[model samples]
Target: MKMFLSHLDSPLGTMLLVTDDRQVVRALDFADHKAHLHRGLREHYGEVVLAEILPPVGIVGALVRYFAGELEALNELPTQTAGSDLQRRVWGALRRIPAGSTTTYGKLAKELGFDDPRAAIDIGAANGANPVAIIVPCHRVIGSNGDLKGYAWGLHRKRWLLEHEKAMKPAKEEGRTAMLPGF
Candidate 1:
C-alpha cells in the first residue's frame, strides 16, 4: 500500500502522520523517530512506498484541538495499525484507557487476563511497538511503582502528555456536570 506522509508542528514537537490510501491514519510518531517509523512501516506493509503530501485536514484539526487542551478531540480520529493478535488487543486496550488515567504494565496484563511476569513484559513490548502514538495512547501506561517508564517517543513527551491530560481533566469534568444538587 502507498503511504501518505505529512508533518505537523505540535507543542510537544514535530509529528509525522502517515495515512493509507483511504486516509485512515497508519502511524503518527515524533519526527525524531523517523527511522523507527519507517522500520515499522516496512515491517508491517513490506515494500511499501511513501509519498509526501498534506494529511487530511480533519485529522490535523483534531490534533490541533487536542493540543489546544480539548483532550477528547483525539478520541475521534480513525487509526489503522498492523500487528499480531496480541499486539492488536493491547493497542485496543490502550485506547480504552481514559485520558487522565493510567495503568501499569502489570495491571494492563491482569486486565488482559495475564498474571505472569512474562505476560506483563509482552504487554510492555506491544505498547512500545505501537505504530500510532497519542491516538493509540500508549503513553498512559506507567511502571508498576508509578514511575514513568519506556516511551518510544521519549519519556519527557510521555510526562508532558500525562500532565496535559491531568490538567485538562478538571476543566473537562466541570463542563460536564453541576456541582450543586437538583437546582
Candidate 2:
C-alpha cells in the first residue's frame, strides 16, 4: 500500500499525518515520540511511502482547528482501519467520543457491554493499537480519575488533545447531573 506523510502545525507542535489510498492511518504528535512512531510504522507496514491524498488533509485541517478551539465536533474525517472484529468495535466506540469531551476506559468498556471493569484495560489496548489517530479519537480516552494517561504519541500530546476538546465544548453546569463529566 502506498502511504502519504504530511507535517501539520497545531497548538501542541508539529504533528505528522500518515495515510494510505483508503484512509488515514496515523496522526502523531511531534513532541518527543516521532522516532518511536517512525520505528513502529516501519515495523508494522514494512516500508514508508508518500502519496498525495487530499482527503486526509481536510481532516488534518479540522484537527488543527479543533486544537485551536474552533471546532466542537469532529465529524469530517472518515475512519478506515484494519483490525479484528472486537478491535473494530473498539475503534467505533472511540469515534463516539465527542469532541471537547473525554471518557474513561471503564466507561468505554461499559459502552462495549463488558461487565468487568478490567475489560477497560483491554479496551485501552485496542485503542492504543488503532491505526487511525484523531479520526478514531483514541486520545479521548482518559483515566478513571479524569487524568490524562497513555497515548501512542505521548502523554503531553494527550493532555493537549483533552484540553483542546474542552476548549471547543461548552462548559458543563456544575451539579446539573452530567451523563459524563470532564469530557
The prediction achieving the highest lDDT against the true structure is 1
Q: Would you list the C-alpha lDDT of every candidate in the order shown?
A: 0.87, 0.68
lDDT digits (tens) for residues 132-158 of candidate 2: 556678888888886677888666556
Deviation in angstroms for 32 in model 2? 3.8
In model 1, the number of clashes is 0
In model 1, pairs of residues that clash are none
Per-residue lDDT tens digits for candidate 1, residues 1-183, read 788999988877789999988889999988989999999999988987889998789999999999888988988988888899999999999999988889999999999999787798999999999999999999999988888899998876787788788822322345663222222
Error of 1 at 54 (Å): 1.0
- Which is the leading candidate under TM-score? 1
